[model samples]
Target: MITVDEIKRMLPHRYPMLLVDRVTELVPGERASGLKAVTCNEPWYEGMPDTATEEDYHYPWTVLIESWCHVAGVLVTWDRPNPDVRSGKAMLLGGIADAEFHRPVVPGDVVEHHVRLARQVGETYVFEGESLVGKETALTIGRLTMTMRPASDLTAPPVPDPL
Candidate 1:
């Protein structure tokens, strides 16, 4: 088991935004499995009104995908850990394709994301996998691409809104 502390040593993600809670399994340069325990304490739930219904509490799909990506991030960077993006190459999501959500994730759910390295070319990596709640699959990552770029590349000023 990789504690959240260890995960912090691998990825630059931090709390609330640091969706992955712990890594249960990891095969460096190959595959990994990690967990995220959803809870009402999550900042995303703070905006709820007193009238909010059960549907309103379902974990946002965007956050779910982000959580899964964090695990994949751990897998690809395990062999070459770079927690600080200021010094070494940093991993960035290049693309997400064919993702399918199987069920609604609620506050009580514990999601386990399983990620596999499908292929790698130069600094780019292709990963495939799924997330599960209990024994049932919760989401499928049909294809996700990640790339390694020099830390300096990530320092480019944010693009201005076209509006």
Candidate 2:
């Protein structure tokens, strides 16, 4: 089991963006399971109007996907010592394919992310997993790929003025 503090040390995320709360199970290069407690106090829920519809109030799918990716990040870097702690490198989400959302996730949900490392080729890691709320699968990810590289490599060049 890994505490939130330990998770913080391993991941680059912070408040509001740091999704994974605890890691209950992990196997260095094979698989992992993590938990994320969603609450109404989240930043995404701050401005939600009382008159909002269920669709409008539902937790964003993008954030849900990110939460899963964060867990995958921890699993991939498990064997390394403080892999993301102030390191100039970062794990980038290369791509996501075949994602399907089956149920809506709300504030009171405790999301359980289960991930399995399918394979690794060079610096790229491929993963397959699902996010569950209780016994129901909330989301299924058929393929999620991540690549580790220097953070500087992702910096975009300044845009030129309009012609």
Candidate 3:
């Protein structure tokens, strides 16, 4: 099992961008299961200076997709034996297909993300990932294609206090 503190070693994303909270299961070229605990303190909640309430805070669809991508990236990295020594790679979101959102995700939700490698051709890894809030599915079967970049690209500092 990989906790949020451990995930920081593999990815350079910091607070507000670092999405995955914990990685429970990982299998190389197979599948991975990740956990994310959403909270009211999420930086996205703070809007402009005039914002009085969070009712207007909207979680963009693109950001949600990015979260999914982060899950997939963690799976791939954790699959390796020595993730720390590795230069740290970047998974570019090539594309997303057959994506459907059933409901909105609010604060105080523990979302489980399951990502499996559906197939791989050349450098592209095709994966099927979904997000669930308890028993209810927030996202359905969706396809994601990501291309790996050299591990040297992760130059940013580690994410802090997001668990």
Report the number of the highest-lDDT candidate. 1
Candidate number with greatest TM-score: 1
For candidate 3, the 10 contiguous residues with the lowest summed lDDT are 154-163
lDDT of 3: 0.71
* Per-residue C-alpha lDDT of model 1 across residues 114-140, encoded as one tens digit per residue: 999888877777889999999998899
Global lDDT for candidate 1?
0.85
Judging by TM-score, tell me the better candidate of 1 and 2: 1
lDDT of each: 0.85, 0.83, 0.71
lDDT of 3 by residue, 1-163 (tens): 8888788766667777888888888887899888888776778666446745455544555666677777788766654522433554555666778888876776777888889988777656788978888998878656887766556654643222111
Alpha-carbon deviation at 132 in model 1, angstroms: 0.7
Candidate 3's displacement at residue 160, Å, is 34
Off by over 4 Å in 1: 155-163
Report the error of model 1 at residue 49, Å: 0.7
Model 1: how far residue 106 lies from native, Å: 0.3
Give the better candidate number (1 or 3) by lDDT: 1
> C-alpha displacement of 148 in model 3, angstroms?
0.9
